[model samples]
Target: MQRRGFLKLGVGAAVVIGVAGAGVALIKPGLVDGKLGPGARDVMRAAAQAVLYDLLPPPGAARDAALALQLDRLDAFIASLPAPTRKELSDALGLLATAAGRFALVGLSRPWAEATVYEVHEALNAMRVSTSNTRQQIYHALRDLNVVAFFNSPDNWRSVGYPGPVQIP
Candidate 1:
């Protein structure tokens, strides 16, 4: 083959390999089959409990059921997001799933599921007040998801004194 043609082929091959590697990196284990894996789900549950502790019903079957419903809703909402957004959330959740990531991001060396409510609260507060924009973004995203999932439910309307939609004439 001509030297110029060989160079062009080599460049094309390198580009293809780079693109393939990037695609593989995007498919992390935290998102299994395009949904949150068990670890990620657990992290999200802990986050919801911590961030919405005051707003949630008292500890009992009722609270458990409410959290389950909200988690389901959040899962659905996440599934409906665009691919890039979903991947971003999955990546964030993946980080939260690991002890190393927890310590790095929240300054806690324990898994999120094992962290006390107070500990989780402190971690979340740290994220909220951190100088790093990524930390703030993670805090906001989790907080917003928790609040939106909880308050949007009909069961929670009474807590905020928001009556149901108006009746038609």
Candidate 2:
């Protein structure tokens, strides 16, 4: 586990990725496919970071809003992902959302907040443990989704006086 060896591994992985890209261009769509895109990965990472900030008790409006925007971008990204990968991500999100919704129904802000937070975190944990190529993407999705659930929660909205923004017809 020398530092030099680790660095070499990193370099090797990058080379592999570069070769894969060249191969993809040379090969046909039917031959092989990898749906995740760099832009989407960026969105996911940003979203995850935002959610981390928003989960604090007081909540973070700027971060939450940022995460929401990222989620919108993610929605588009998800569409481009392989169908199986999309389904996996969707299922994980659905679990988190369902837990959040149940907690919201009870008006238990604190627990709802906790459950929502944990669910997304758990999703990220699962993604990391799995062999999915989109582990990073899932991590991003979980992070963003949690922030969205938190900011949109009744408690956060009431605290912030976040009236739906004015319509701009």
Candidate 3:
């Protein structure tokens, strides 16, 4: 009888706590948040790829030369990093490159959204860090890159503080 009573009391307490938490979440609009669906992930990947590609110098008769130059610069920088840090940076860069490559193969069905971007930020944080400069540069690159790629596009310009031209014809 005593054990049964204690179990019921415990269950009741748990139910109460659960209900209280739900109530708090309802009362505080920002207390609880949602996550990105798979669709958002695909969009983010596509947007990231587009942003990088757009930032790259245009391919012309100089295409090979430009690529070689960029590769050499990146290789030298990677080599200068400490061994472990280099490996981590390499891994992160490789992952991003892979994603970018995949994006080029099949364009996204939808546009990138803010919720999905949170996942990107989380992944970057997990990837690796070398020097403070590397960290800052990467962070700035990713943040700026994504913002310009996703939010600065024609469809998103208004939300991103872009004022379209006022032309008098």
Candidate 4:
């Protein structure tokens, strides 16, 4: 594409995403009062499952507990973020929770709650390689947030083969 055409596409993607974010926030409101509600948690859970599939335990009670812990950590981390950052995160999560947004942005036609780990993984991979910078940023935000939340707990370090931080005298 020509430089001007590319620039226009970029601007167009930004505007559409912003408008969708706002509309999703006002309509369904995945986050209640800037907190992760059921919808937000569902979105995060799906993405986390995809991004951390290898790191996560096999399906069972252990896996469920691990996911629960990660979600809890994510909630705490979001609570610590600045208002604007938290709002953006909320909006992003909210967008992912919507059917139209999920299909348009993540390329996932199925609901997050119903999507398999493999399906979610494919969707995320698609976003990561998309021509749209906006989609790449969204992928990073979703993946990185889950990575941070999963690794924030020292208890999870053994899973990733990290022996904990090096001791300094």
Top candidate on TM-score is 4
lDDT of 2 at 29: 26
Q: Order of all candidates by TM-score, from best down to worst?
A: 4, 1, 2, 3
Every candidate's lDDT = 0.78, 0.47, 0.41, 0.85
Candidate 2 accuracy as lDDT: 0.47
Off by over 4 Å in 2: 1-60, 99-169
Q: What's the distance in Å from true for residue 34, model 2?
A: 18
Number of colliding residue pairs in model 4: 0
Question: Which residue runs of candidate 3 sit more than 4 Å off their true CA positions?
Answer: 1-58, 98-169
Please identify model 1 stretches exceeding 4 Å from their true place: 1-28, 167-169
Cα displacement (angstroms), candidate 3, residue 21, comes to 34
TM-score computed on alpha carbons, candidate 4 = 0.86
Question: Which number leads on lDDT?
Answer: 4
- lDDT (Cα, 0-100) at 19 in candidate 1: 59
The superposed Cα distance between candidate 2 and the true structure at residue 128, in angstroms, equals: 6.4
Candidate 3 pairs with clashing backbones: none
What's the TM-score of every candidate structure? 0.77, 0.31, 0.29, 0.86
Model 2 reaches what TM-score against the true structure? 0.31
lDDT of 2 by residue, 14-116 (tens): 6775465445423322112233233333324433553554443344776567555555544545556687766555444332233232222222233323445
| Residue 5's lDDT in candidate 3 | 100
